[model samples]
Target: VARLQERARLFLELATQRGLDTGLSRGSAVIPVIIGDSALSLRLADRLFEQGINVHAISYPAVEEHKARLRFFITTLHSPDQIRFTVDALATTLSELRQEALYITPTN
Candidate 1:
């Protein structure tokens, strides 16, 4: 449990430094990176999945609306390198998605 907690702390710090909203962590194994938009959250999750990182995108009904997030679980089995890689991938993927959103025109 201690190792898990330590990894979680590291993850939170790295994620926060990268501007990812990780305000839902309590120094536990579970860390929630709040994206605030349901579509963005799901896109991030799917993008991460394509990159081989599997995490759950939590949205309304399970959590409050507009507080959609990707929940990350840090375990003892995960090394520091793995955590860093995951964070890097998440940041990159999210940035890409935000950039894409900027140019998306409404069809209506």
Candidate 2:
């Protein structure tokens, strides 16, 4: 479980560094990238799927509305390279979505 925690920590740090939210993930194997918009969450999941990452999209009912997110589960089997690739892919995909105007950045 220590290995899993470490992987999760790495993923959280990398994702947070890229401006993605590692929501409610306190050393847990599950890391959630909160996207806020349900449609954007689903689109991000689909985009990641196209890049061979199988993350799940959590939307309203599963979570509160406007708190939709993409959920990633980290395992000890994942290597650091894989984690880096996933984070890069996620960031790229999100940037692409933003460029396409499918994602609207939320104002604080």
Candidate 3:
């Protein structure tokens, strides 16, 4: 649960920085950033469907279940530039969604 708590903290900080605006869409309202085989599970799908959360569910042929994810959460101490970079990285990495191949694959 420690990991989940830390991740939640990171996401809240990020969303706040993004100008949470009205406190809606800040915390658990849009989280858990589903990962692994858990993403394919019925429970998770139901939770997402029922909650209507804006989950960014990543799927296979892209990443295995263990890696397939809507990756969110970053350290609070990371600089704005660092956070921007991370966001940019995600945008580029997932650009296929936009029909723009910003990156063929993520680098190590």
Query: Model 2 has how many clashing residue pairs?
Result: 0
Ranking by TM-score: 1, 2, 3
CA-lDDT, candidates in order:
0.90, 0.89, 0.44
Error of 2 at 99 (Å): 2.0
**How well does model 1 score by local distance difference test?**
0.90
> TM per model?
0.94, 0.89, 0.31
Q: Count the clashes in each prediction.
A: 0, 0, 0
Index of the highest-TM-score prediction: 1
Supply the TM-score for candidate 2.
0.89
- Which portions of model 1 miss their true places by more than 4 Å? none
Q: Which is better, 1 or 3, measured by TM-score?
A: 1
* lDDT digits (tens) for residues 1-108 of candidate 2: 788888989999999899987777888888888888888889999989988999999999899967898989899999999999999999989888878874556789
The pairs that clash in candidate 2 are none
Which residue runs does candidate 2 get wrong by more than 4 Å?
102-108
Pairs in clash, predicted candidate 3: none
